[model samples]
Target chain A: MKVITIVLQIGFLYVFYITGSLLQRLFHLPIPGSIIGLFLLFIVLLLKVFPATWIETGSAFLLDYLSLLFVPATTGVMNYFDLFAGHTIWLFIITMISTLIVMIFSGHTSRLLARYREKRREGTECQQSLSESSL
Target chain B: MSTVLIGIVFISLTVFIYLFMTRLYHRFYIPFLIPALTSTVAVVFLLIIMEVSYDTYMIGGQWIDALLGPAIVALAYPLYNQRHLLLKNLYPILGGVVVGSLTGIFSGLLLAQSLGFNEKLLFSLLPKSVTTPVAMQIADGVGGLPALSVLFVMTAGFTGVVVGPYILYWFRLDSPLAKGMAFGSASHAIGTAKAIEYGDYTTSVSSVAMTLSAIACSVFGSLVVLVFYA
Candidate 1:
């Protein structure tokens, strides 16, 4: 019974994916269909069009094994050995350096922005309390 | 082997290897021993040793690959769950992901070009920071090799899981929001997994970051391609 529910829920999600693909083709969208499906589902959830429980179990199951699903595609690298042969070290360097740059830049940027927000909130709270006491 | 049997065998083999790798990862808890990386290497080498052509392997592999689209849609659940937190911290999260996505694209293109890589390789490197499925799509759209883009995405993911924490600590980015945004924007799903160590709030923030970064890159990435390749 539980297995059937999960299967049905997954089927429901697949419907969204198909619809997204159709929309992409009809409209000539540059974005991937799966992404459009994701956005549609997100909008549906946000609008309370359906209860979250309907797809909860199935989405959880799929997300848990998400990395596993990537295996076949990742393994496709086997077919592209020639392109990667001379560039292995350079590829690693570029990915590593870029990864570091992104991590640092985003991390610090958010942290500073968050701190700025926090300080502003505190300042407003302090002003409110002072005004209330004066009143 | 018959086509039906080959499909079943390959699917089972991939699943079994993934399960075994997961167990090994949990036992050792090493960053580099991630199941995705290990199982992929294992399966690839197995195919090479058995002299099995990729086409033959895909007889089953394609079945598994077909699920990737649906799985991507499943990402919406987490995004939904994190909506409250995402809305509350909209500025920081949005600001961080946008900047990060641009940095990923520009830095990757500049470095790769300076190193004298060809146009195809540059396009492949452009979407390396986004999650694999979307990155593959963007790469295909931009005249890059989708398969090679996966390699770059995996490398970025691995690099983040391994080195991201140290960078965060060195920079004293103690806020959960900062930590989550860093991992998700830089590394996608793999980085989100690492963010789990910081607790649930960080995990939620990281997942949101991952999704937003994907959306940002997909939109901005094409514009970057138009500027360069067009």
Candidate 2:
């Protein structure tokens, strides 16, 4: 019974994926079918058409095994070995440099904005309390 | 052998090795060691030693590959769980991810282009900041190699795992929201894994950032391709 429920829940996810696949084909969207399916599932959840419990087991199962699913792609890296032979140094340099720059800039930018918002919220709260005290 | 039999045995071998390495990493608690890196290294070496062709390995590998789509679709569950937090911090999350993704895309592109890298390589590197599944999809959409893009994504994730925490520390950025967003947007899953070490709140926030970044990078990547490349 438990296994059957998990299977049915997974089936629910696939239904969304099929819808996404069909939408992608019909519309020629650049988005992947899976992503469109993700959006559809999100909207379905948001609307309370189905509660989280309905899919939690299957979702948890898939996510727990997420890294395992990616093993194939990592091995696919071997296919590009010849391509990297002449450009190994360049690939390494570009990947490291770009990654560093992105991490630093994004980290700084997000922290800066979050702080700014936080300070502004405090200010608004202080003003509200001041007004309330005066009243 | 039969191809089907080879595929079965090969997959079992890969999973066994991967699980073993994961346990080893957890037990040792090595600061820089990541299971994906170690497992990939181990599997590649084992395959080479065994003379198992990439074709044969993929015969089993493809079973894992097929799950990528549903896994991505399942991502929506996390996003849905965080809907309230997302609504509350909408502006900051949106602002941060947009800037972070643009930084990721442009920095990689300009650097590679300046180095005179070819178009295929440039496109592969373009989606390095997004999660692997979406990154691969974007790479294919933009006429790049999907496999290569996954490599770049992994590299970026590793980079984040190695350097991400130190950068946040040096800057004294203690906000959980900021830390999570930075890690998720810039490094994808690897960064999120690091964020998980921070605490539960950070993990939830990073999940939000990772999901949003994937969506942003995809939409933004296609637009760049449509407008600039085409």
Candidate 3:
């Protein structure tokens, strides 16, 4: 029973994958087919076209082992080991600095916006209180 | 043994080493001891010392690599689970991700270009802010070496996970939403792991931010590529 259910879940995912690939080929999309497939799955789930239970188990199982799948590609970096020789320090510095910059700017912007909304609400509340007191 | 058998052996060996190292990392609780980074480094060294060709290693490695697509597609489940939170906080989430992703790309490209890195390297570095699967796709779409982009994304992930908390505290940004966006936008999944340390709210928000950034990149990242390569 478990095995059959898992197979059905995989079948559902494969359908989305095929849909994504077909769309990409027809439209010449720059995005990866798998991501397009993800969007398809997301939309279907959003609209209740497919019950989440249909794919949840299989997706959870796959995602659970997701990091394992990356090992091969992570090891593929060896092919470019020579590229790292001259640029290792530079690459490290650039990635570190850029990530830091991203964190700072994104966090700062979100916080600033949050603070602004809070202040506006507070201002409106103050005005309401003042008018009630005057009355 | 046949090459195919050898490849399978290598895969098992790598998985064993990775799992072992992860347990060690958890026991010790050291940032630099990340299982992925440490295992990659160790395996690379082992291969070099043993005179095993990378192609030989990849015989098994490619099998694992192929799963990246499905694994990435499965991300939709988690994203779907958090859909309501995403919609509720859509404005700030979108605002932070768009700005952060653009900031990541521009900063990496300009810095590399100024330092005289080749165009290929520039393309590889462009998607450093995203998760590995999405990063690889964006890199390949933009004519970069997908393998090289993996390296860059891992570095970005490591750096973001390590330095992200300090940066957040340094800037005095305490909101869960802000913290989550910062990690998800800058580092992707590994950073999201760091965000999870805070609470469920931060984790869900980080997941939404990471998902948003991937969609934004897939849609607009190509435009950045077209501007350069076209």
Candidate 4:
């Protein structure tokens, strides 16, 4: 099962990679593979093709250690001290302002959409439960 | 014997300093950004002021660097857990990546170009808005150096961590899923790390979002390179 889990994850990531490549190759759209892989998994789950337990353990294991990914890049910053000396002001100013914009807009938009969906779901569930009780 | 002894001592000290700091980060500094962020900031300053070459500092930093690849492989969980919601909201998530990556890259590239930056600088800055690994690959894939990519990625991560929360709050981003997705989509893992600070659900969602964003940004970034620069 552990080996199965590893195989599944690698397989899924490749699926994401391939799907992302094909999307760009065929449609010239700006979509990414990870997102596509996510979607593929989403579809499989919704259709009951794969059970929840199948991916749960492996997925959790990955999240536990994900932060370590940035260490190499962060540590590598030691190499570019001069680069910063030249561009600290530019880098600081640009990174701060632009990242703020990206996060705020993206986060806000998704939240609003989620809100709409949650409300819709609750309303439907309420209606169903009420109808069943009445019958 | 003396040189080897010094090298061993130096290795131990780096390990001690990093572990101590990491413990502090996990404990006392739980709510705030990790000490690693401050350490990153401090190290950058030390390198320039001390006139120490980046390569010299990397000698010690390499101990920490070795863990990065496995961390990336670990991002499988959050994606796995949210498989159902991910399916339910697949279209929107896909739409989010498309709009987000394009807007980020074009605006970023155009601004740099308009500012009269050269191609080398442009290559470095182009991947600045994404996560570390994918950003490095995209940078290398386009004529930029990996060293430059790492620098840009840290800057982006720092920027994302500082700014992501305020934006979420101001926008009243109350959903864990959206919060995670936004952070993941924008900053990659660093942003997701911050999102995790908000709660478990936020962390998980943001992580999946981050991985997806990396995969998206890479493909889109490469395609852009091939189309225009190639």
Candidate 5:
């Protein structure tokens, strides 16, 4: 069953592999092929073509090791040593500062929306209290 | 003849590297990618400085890189598993991705433009905030260097890890699902992992969002780029 499970999981990966090539050839889509495969799986599941276990094991294995997939790209960063050296101070300054800005803004924006919702909720409660007191 | 022996030696070495990275990550509370990336860079750079060609490095590395295709396929399983929860928050998920992606691209581009960066660098900088593969593809398609996109991606991932949660928490997005999905959609796989760490509820939703956004990117991200070209 273990081998069978692994085989099924790997088989699913093959489906995605083929989808990648398909999207490339047919649509000339700028998207990667694997992403198309993912969409196919989404559609299939939404339609209930498979059981939950089929979904669970395969998904867990992939997501758990997803970081490992970027090994090549991560190493590929080294090729940019010259780019970094060119504006070491400037690029570092820009990247570092900008990343913090992105972080702070996105965090606060989401938090603000949540807070605004809470304030609105509190306002309704206060109004309800006043109406009850009037009675 | 000796290539096979070297190949075996290389495989074991890569495993050792992975194991070493895993241990370092566990012990130090650093993110996993940092070690994986740093070690790969350190090892590869040593090889390069020692006069080894990229092809030789790739000989070992490709074994690792080959898994990327399969890993992407794995993204969907999470989506499938989280179907019920996703159906509940589908609108927010899509809204967050579109808003987050466009805002990220726009801000990065505008910031560079305001700073008076040249056109080529500006074009390269536009997609820096997206995930690596998608970002790299966008960069390459528009005649920017794929390499720069990769750098942008790593930098983005590093930034996401450092600053993503603070923003999520700051916004009081205490709903683990919302926090995770936002990070996953905006930041991609690396961000998704961090999202998962935030909580199970968020991790599950974020995993779903991360996978979908990649699909969304192919559909939407291209259109955005096309507008620039047209």
Candidate 6:
């Protein structure tokens, strides 16, 4: 019974994916159907159209083995060895450098924004305390 | 081997290898020893040594591949769960992901171009920071090889997981939100897994950032492709 429930939940997730594909074709959107499905599911959840429990177990199971699902696609790189043959080192350097840059850029950007928000909150709290003391 | 037999053998082989690699990763706790990276290398090596062509391996591999779409859709659950936190810190998360996604796309393009990479390779590398499926889709739309884009995405993911922590510490990006944003925007899901070590809040924020970054990358990536390729 437990296995069947999980299977059915996964099947339910697939329904969203099919709907996304259909919408993509109908709208001629540039976005992928899977992504469209993701947005659709997110919206449905946000609106409380269905309880989260409906897909909880299924999503958990899939997220657990998410890395495993990537193996086949990653392995597809075998057929394209020629593309990386002469440029392996350059590719490595570029990816590493760009990744580092992005991490730092995004990290610092959020950190600064978070700090600013924290300071603003603290300032408001301080003002409220001051006003209360005066009263 | 018959088609059915090949599919069963390769699918089982991949599962077995992934399980073994997961065990190894848990034991060593090394950043580079991630199951995804190690198992993929192991499977590719096995296929090559057995004189098996990629097509035959894919015959079985496609079964697993078919699950990727739904798995991606399943990402919505985490994003949904984190809705409260996402709403509370909307500005920081949105600001960080937007900056990160644009930087990821443009920087990759500039670096690849500077290195004299060919047009096909350059476009393939454009979506490197996105999660695999979205990256592959964007790559295809932009005249790049989707398979090759996967390779670049894996590289970017591994690099982020391996190096991201040190950079975060070195720069004192100590906030949970900042750490999560950095990993998710720069490296996608692999980095999100790494974010688990930090704590639950970090993990939640990371998953949220990962999803938003994918959307942001898709938009920015498409625009870049259009401006240059069209």
Show where candidate 4 strays beyond 4 Å.
Answer: A1-69, A86-92, A116-135, B1-15, B19-33, B42-63, B223-230
Better of 1 and 4 by TM-score: 1
User: Is candidate 2 or 6 superior in DockQ?
Assistant: 6
Q: Could you give me the TM-score of model 6 versus the true structure?
A: 0.91
How far out, in Å, is residue B69 in model 5?
Answer: 1.5
Best by TM-score: 6
**How close to the true structure is residue A106 of candidate 5, measured as C-alpha lDDT?**
42
Colliding pairs, model 4: A32-B216, A59-B76, A59-B77, A60-B77, A62-B74, A78-B54, A79-B54, B180-B206
What are the iRMS values of all candidates? 2.0, 2.2, 2.5, 4.7, 3.1, 1.8
The C-alpha local distance difference test score for the whole of candidate 4 amounts to 0.62
lDDT (Cα, tens digit) per residue for candidate 1, span B147-182: 788888988987898777778888887888888998
lDDT string for model 5 (B1-230, tens) is 37666566555666677668767776876543455465575667666777765566666677767767767666666566666766765555555555555566666666766777765665666565556667777776665667766676667666666565566566665676557656665566677666655655576666565655555554554576678644
- Highest DockQ scorer: 6
lDDT of 6 by residue, A1-135 (tens): 878878998999999999998998899875678878988999999899999999999988887887888889788778877766675568767988898899899888888887899899999999999999999
lDDT of 2 at B202: 69
Candidates in order, TM-scores: namely 0.90, 0.87, 0.82, 0.69, 0.81, 0.91
| TM-score of chain A, all candidates | 0.91, 0.87, 0.78, 0.54, 0.69, 0.91
Docking tier of model 5: it is: acceptable
Task: List model 3 lDDT by residue over A42-126, tens digit each.
Answer: 8988999978998888877666555566667667677777867765569768988999999899887777776777788899999
Error of 5 at A32 (Å): 1.0
C-alpha lDDT (0 to 100) for residue B4 of candidate 1: 98
User: By DockQ thresholds, what CAPRI class is model 6?
Assistant: medium
Ranking by DockQ: 6, 1, 2, 3, 5, 4
Per-candidate clashes come to 0, 0, 0, 8, 5, 0
Query: What TM-score is obtained for chain B in each of the predicted models?
Result: 0.83, 0.81, 0.78, 0.78, 0.81, 0.85
Residue by residue across B122-164, what tens digits does model 6's lDDT show? 8888888988878887888888988877888888888888778
Candidate 2 ranges beyond 4 A from true positions:
A1-4, B118-120, B133-147, B189-204, B218-230
